[model samples]
Target: MIDTRMIGDVRVTRIHEYSGPTHDPKFLLPDLSQELLESNREWMSPHHWIPLMNKLILTVQLWVVHAGSNIIVVDTGVGNRKPREGMARMHNLNSLVLEWLEAAGAPPDKVTHVALTHLHMDHVGWNTRWLDGRWTPTFPNARYYLPQDDFLFCESGRNKQEGLDVFGASFEDSVMPIVDAGMSVMLKPGMEIGDCLQVEDARGHSPGQVAFRIRSRGEEAIFSGDICHNPIQIVHPEINSGYCIWPDQARKTRMEFLASSADRETLVLPVHFGNPYAGFVRREGAGFRFEPLLW
Candidate 1:
């Protein structure tokens, strides 16, 4: 299913890729306490957390933004038929991401730009599709904006050496093809796309992870990628996901983003948030609260 919302003149549409019970609350967020989980259980049950299954629900999705003539795609989800042996959930499977994008009103061909928050397997998988005989650039007309640090890091094959084969394989099949096709552009902090989307430093989840800030007519929203996987993090910013490479930095980034979003009343659209995916962060006492955008 797709959810559409207007942020001033820019139209934002979320195209769903995958959604289910993903991880254990304690497993995903090691810093979370049972008391805290139980405290928030009333509001989190069924949507963000499944008490019966002891799993944290997550959704893998991408955002399509329409800014005048620019058809921008925010982080692509895991693509069809990829070798992700290390991560069972992302391994050799087929998903109708392209069809969903089309249904969301932004087809692959119409996508003018692709902005990736990081180079993780799930975020960059749809960069290429198995076409003809090999992996090919899925968005042929789009110039893919990739983080320079991550591109260099993944290109160095260090992730594989460090036993992150899932990311390495994804880089090989998904990202490299974009570079080989000469459609890749290095993204930098404070970079603006079409005068509405601005890139901000959001490193921590990955070395070069960044977030996009969309603004128009005084309204704003942040396409935060994996900074906080679930809304639970809004109330507990210190809890870092197990996948975070730099825990300290990740926590700091999350806290900062949450505080800023709350102060500015900006919409928070994280990649792994459950249904009614986007929301607003509001300051509550010493922490924050998530106000889901139900419309």
Candidate 2:
């Protein structure tokens, strides 16, 4: 289960997963390739890696006001039976995500929208469910938002040509189900679905990756979906992950995101971090740090 916070009139719910030690160590912010290559060491010890309070890693669910009406889920995590073997071992999808959603009072029908930050498997798994031996969009009444660039990248020869069918079925089974049902829309950056929520292109992890910014009653927060995996990356913005398609581009994107939210007033919702849904970016010694929101 996760905590729920209200920003202005919007009730922001965070569905967290205590996926300690199950995730790939490399995905940790300090283990990014750029940071690894710069340092001679292979990894950081547990002492150096632990958070200030010795906390564990926590993933988040960002629920924004749906078209200023209801709620929209951003980036559903790995769902059940997602083929988690070998390199993808860490990509396991359990029912807790959906359970947490229900616990937070959001049933499958309650979620009216699912915004895919990118076409990555981990971000899109829960977009659909396995039913009658086929994958189908989880939300019947909701529309799935896909960035045109990301859709093309995934559907193109990128994964299939290499015989890597990890996230392929998700688009076809989960996303396309909604699309065929007329519930999916290919969106461009800066598209406004409502008065409160807006999509912005923060590409680089993927060609057309985007982030959602939700503003309500003079207070605003950005659902930074996978742009930076952990808080440590905020301090070491130059780091690049192995999955990063373009290292340089990813770096630039992260920098821009940091700059945009560096101010104390802005709430940054990092999709995968230990705790605190929103945080204030602060200038530390040589780089920036994420100061988690107290409330």
Best by TM-score: 1
lDDT by candidate, in order shown: 0.88, 0.67
- 1-295: candidate 1 lDDT, tens digit per residue: 8889999999999988899897878877888887899899988988999988889998889899999999999999998998887667888879888998889878899999999999988899898999999999999999999998888878887766666343667888999889989999999888987567899999888888999999888899999999999999898888888778878999999999998999998999889988788899998898898898976
In order of appearance, the predictions have TM-scores of 0.96, 0.83
Off by over 4 Å in 2: 23-68, 87-92, 160-169
lDDT (Cα) of model 1: 0.88
Candidate 1 displacement at residue 150 in angstroms: 1.1
Instruction: Look at candidate 2 and tell me the lDDT of residue 69.
Output: 62
lDDT of 2 by residue, 174-206 (tens): 566666777778978989654556889888777
* Alpha-carbon lDDT of model 2: 0.67
lDDT of 1 at 189: 88
Model 2 residue 166 distance off true place after TM-score fit, in angstroms: 7.1
